[model samples]
Target: MSIQRRHTAQQLGDCFKVAAELALPVLGRQSRHLDGLTDIKLVHGIVSGQGKLSGLRFTHAWVEGLDDNGVKYVVDASNGREVALPSDLYYLIGEISPSECVRFTPEQARRHLLDAGHYGPWCGAPFEHEDPVPGVAA
Candidate 1:
């Protein structure tokens, strides 16, 4: 079956928060499925796609990892549902450029969060210097 495109009103601009939660066992939460994954990295970048966010380049975050078979996948929970797609497919659909992405390991992510005090576009990407959502601090 083909992967379905799903979006939720609540998840519109919460990509960073969702990604952080998924990548680290913060708030006493952990994704059990990620236990078997390897080389996991939290990524932040500008993304534009063909759905509600069509034609709009915005800061987004997600997790990337390799499965046991060594296939790379992009896992996103920003839509309020976890979706894992092949990294190439996800990048193509989101119009994301590898060179423009900022990646962090779980340890690095924790440090950044502690240093920046927020889930963020910490690398100062031209498109993302501030929080995407105002007053939310996520």
Candidate 2:
């Protein structure tokens, strides 16, 4: 069965924190056995779609994991709900271009979080030309 989109009325802007929390545990091997997933990663990229982020190509974060059957999925808990979508569907809905995304392994995420001191857009994020939104750390 296909996973349906799950979200609440809450406005979503904390993609980084949510994604990091979900990714770190699995990537660090702290919760790997819980779901039988592998090759987990934290993905950061520019996205544009409906809701709060509509009409803007802003930096966003999410986690990706490969299931036992080798199918990839995107797990997002940013909008006050946790939803897991097939990778292709997630990318299509978000209008995410793979070439513009940066994927981080557990080790890289930890190192970057330590060195940068934040969840991040990290270096080489695609939002260089976009003006920063007030109260948003992108």
Candidate 3:
């Protein structure tokens, strides 16, 4: 089954909540406690555009694992701010490899969300930018 359900920010937030809850116990318990997120695979990396402007890239954090049917899917909790890209929407890019997902504390995760340039409500950053790509001065 091809899962096409788009998760609302609220729903996605809950996913992060679960990650945070699971995260609390792992802190200091084990160094890589946040990696698996119980059943979810949390990943932080860049997913890039595959079209002519394929040079365009985005830095993001996402969760991936099998659904009830065992179909793997990528869950982007960024709330569409910086292209909450589905796995199919873009290909992975840079040294920020998704295959090597790193676990972060709740606080670290929050900072990463903001640092990755999220423009949504959870980001708490004062500014919002439509373009995910960093601007270069001419």
Q: Best-fitting candidate, measured by TM-score?
A: 1
Candidate 2 local distance difference test against the native: 0.70
Off by over 4 Å in 3: 1-38, 49-54, 79-138
Rank ordering of all candidates by lDDT, starting from the highest: 1, 2, 3
lDDT pick, better of 2 and 3: 2
Candidate lDDT scores, in order, read 0.74, 0.70, 0.38
Q: Could you give candidate 2's per-residue lDDT for residues 1-138 as a string of tens digits?
A: 121223321333677766777878742323332277789898888677576546656677888889988999888877576778888998999888898789999789877776666777676874332222234343
RMSD of 2: 8.0
Q: What local lDDT does model 2 show for residue 14?
A: 72
lDDT of 1 by residue, 1-138 (tens): 122234332445677877887888763545655667899999987677567657656667899999999988988887567778889999998888888789999999888787676777687654333334334444
The candidate, 1 or 2, that scores higher on TM-score is: 1
Using lDDT as the measure, the top candidate is 1
Could you tell me how far off, in angstroms, the CA of residue 3 lies in candidate 1 after the best superposition?
Answer: 28
Task: Count clashes in each candidate, considering only residues at least 3 apart in sequence or on different chains.
Answer: 0, 0, 0
Arrange candidates by TM-score, highest first: which order?
1, 2, 3
User: Model 3 shows how many backbone clashes?
Assistant: 0
Residue 99 error for model 3, in Å? 3.9
- Taking the tens digit of each residue's C-alpha lDDT, what string does model 3 give over 1-138? 121223233333333433333333442322232233334544544434344425544333455544455544454433322223334443343234445345454556546444654322133321112222134221
